[model samples]
Target: MTTPVEVRYFAAAAEAAGRGAEQVLLPAGTTVGGLLDLLAERHGPALRDVAARCALLVDGVLHRDRDAPVGAPTRVDVLPPFAGG
Candidate 1:
């Protein structure tokens, strides 16, 4: 069985997801986009859209592509765009 990964959401993404974070067990070799899809299904449409526009982080490092590979028991963070002057 695959290990459970901890996914953290911030700002609007967190509110939309209705939770600060979640722990999920993904099949081995699952792509980052696949994981987002799973989260969208679990959190609902609002979060799904937010996730689409957000940046992803793995273990505190930015994730550049949806196809990036993530192992089990990883720490994933979803960060939405922030506005500032």
Candidate 2:
């Protein structure tokens, strides 16, 4: 059965998404890249690039690649590079 995935955004990413997080239902065996596309379509182009470079975390573990496998009820966080003093 398909499971719901939680997409979290931080910093500018959050602003682009217009919220801190969202819950989406994804088909089984969805890849990280696919999820990013879904988020970009929902958020917009500006957020799409950020989402592409942003780190992905599944169940609190950092995903290594875009092809990484993601399952239902997954926790995905979009983290943009931080430049602060």
Candidate 3:
């Protein structure tokens, strides 16, 4: 089955994705890395480059581990490194 996930892109990630947010239908039990891969394929290489250094905020929790599995009806924030304190 497919799970619906809300993906929000910020800063450089937003620029790469050309949008601030989107709803993606992902396979059940999809890993963080898998999601990133799918996004790269959908958005192209620019997003791939930014996503490599980006951090994922899953359901309000910060996640850096790519192997982590994402659950359904989740909100994923793609955050790129920012300047300033």
Candidate 4:
């Protein structure tokens, strides 16, 4: 079964995705790693490139464990690299 996950993009990732947020469909219990691969495929090269350097937050916490299953009804926040001084 597939579930919907809300992906929120910020900064360059939003620019790449051409939107701040979107919904993605994934098999139940899919990992963050798997989600990234699927997302890269859906959005094409721009987002694919951003995925490499971006940080992923699932539900409000930084998700470093790509192996962990994505808990559905989830909000995934994507923050890409930024520079300011």
Highest TM-score, which number?
Answer: 3
Q: In candidate 1, where is summed lDDT lowest over 10 consecutive residues?
A: 64-73
TM-score of each: 0.88, 0.85, 0.92, 0.84
Clashing pairs in 1: none
Q: Candidate 3 lDDT, tens digit per residue, 1-85?
A: 9978899999999999999999999899888888899999999999999999888898988877899887764799998889951
In candidate 2, what are the lDDT values of residues 1-85, reduced to their tens digit?
Answer: 6788777899989988999988988888888888888889998998897886687777887775888777664577778777851
Writing each residue's lDDT as its tens digit, candidate 1 over 1-85 gives 6868899999999999999988888888877788888889999999999888888887777875789876664788989888860
- Which regions of candidate 1 fall more than 4 Å away from where they truly are? none
Please tell me which predicted candidate would have the highest lDDT against the true structure. 3
Off by over 4 Å in 3: none
Candidate 4 regions exceeding 4 Å error are none
Off by over 4 Å in 2: none
Estimate the Cα RMSD of every predicted model relative to the unseen true structure. Answer: 1.7, 2.1, 1.4, 2.0
Clashing pairs in 3: none
| Backbone clashes, candidate 1 | 0
Q: Write down the worst ten-residue block by lDDT for model 2.
A: 76-85
Clashing pairs in 2: 4-73
